[model samples]
Target: MWVPVGSMFSFIEVLPLVLLILDAMEHHSLIRKQQRFR
Candidate 1:
């Protein structure tokens, strides 16, 4: 019972990690494009 609860909590924790990774990737690509334009 406790294991299932803990897993759910961790799943919530991972949402922000995934979002941060995606945001960083998008920012990196945008920066590269800007550099190329310059």
Candidate 2:
């Protein structure tokens, strides 16, 4: 393969961190939505 395996592995390593950040952002938006209705 022309692509390096290390870069592919690095993306796998960073995947959870990216997901965690997305999850936090979604949670924060949901909280703000709840506050708006109150």
Candidate 3:
């Protein structure tokens, strides 16, 4: 399988962005749950 080097670098960059978005969504959900419980 052949992959472009530029695409590999872009994927690496986007991977962290995706993770950050997921982490932010999880954090927001947790905050909402805590606020509802309070």
Candidate 4:
């Protein structure tokens, strides 16, 4: 029981970092597109 709960807690901790990385990547792509248009 404790093992599964511990894994779930770790997953929750990592979720935000993953989301942040995805958001950064999206922003980077947008910047690239804007630069291309210029």
Candidate 5:
């Protein structure tokens, strides 16, 4: 019971890290596209 709850919290904590990495990747791709167009 407690173990499952702790795992849930760990997943929640990792969610933001995943989102941050995705956001950075998207920004990097956009910058690359703009550079290519120029």
Candidate 6:
């Protein structure tokens, strides 16, 4: 299957934001768990 350049470019641009969001979520969850243990 052939993909359009614009679509591919957009996906690449958005990938980092998505990864950052996921990393932030994981960090938040870790903090919450640590607080609960106290």
Query: Per-residue alpha-carbon lDDT of model 5 for 1-38, expressed as tens digits?
Result: 89999999999999999999999999999999999999
User: lDDT per residue, candidate 4, 13-38, as tens digits?
Assistant: 99999999999999999999999999
TM-score per candidate: 0.77, 0.83, 0.82, 0.97, 0.93, 0.88
lDDT, model 6: 0.95
lDDT of each: 0.99, 0.95, 0.94, 0.99, 0.99, 0.95
Error of 2 at 10 (Å): 0.7
Candidates 3 and 4, the one with greater lDDT: 4
lDDT tens string, model 6, 1-38? 34688889999999999999999999999999999999
The collision pairs in model 2 are none
- Higher-ranked by TM-score: 1 or 3: 3
Off by over 4 Å in 5: none
Q: What are the runs in model 3 whose C-alpha is more than 4 Å off?
A: 1-3
The per-residue C-alpha lDDT of model 5 at residue 12 equals 100
User: How many collisions per candidate?
Assistant: 0, 0, 0, 0, 0, 0
Worst 10 residues of 1 by lDDT: 1-10
* Residue 20 shift from truth in candidate 3, angstroms: 0.6
Which 10 residues in a row give candidate 6 its minimum summed lDDT? Answer: 1-10
RMSD of model 3, in Å? 2.1
**Which one is best on TM-score?**
4
Which parts of model 2 have CA positions greater than 4 angstroms off? 1-3
Q: Alpha-carbon error at 35 in model 2, in Å?
A: 0.7
Ranking the candidates on TM-score from highest down gives 4, 5, 6, 2, 3, 1
Predicted structure 6: clash tally: 0
Q: Alpha-carbon error at 34 in model 6, in Å?
A: 0.2
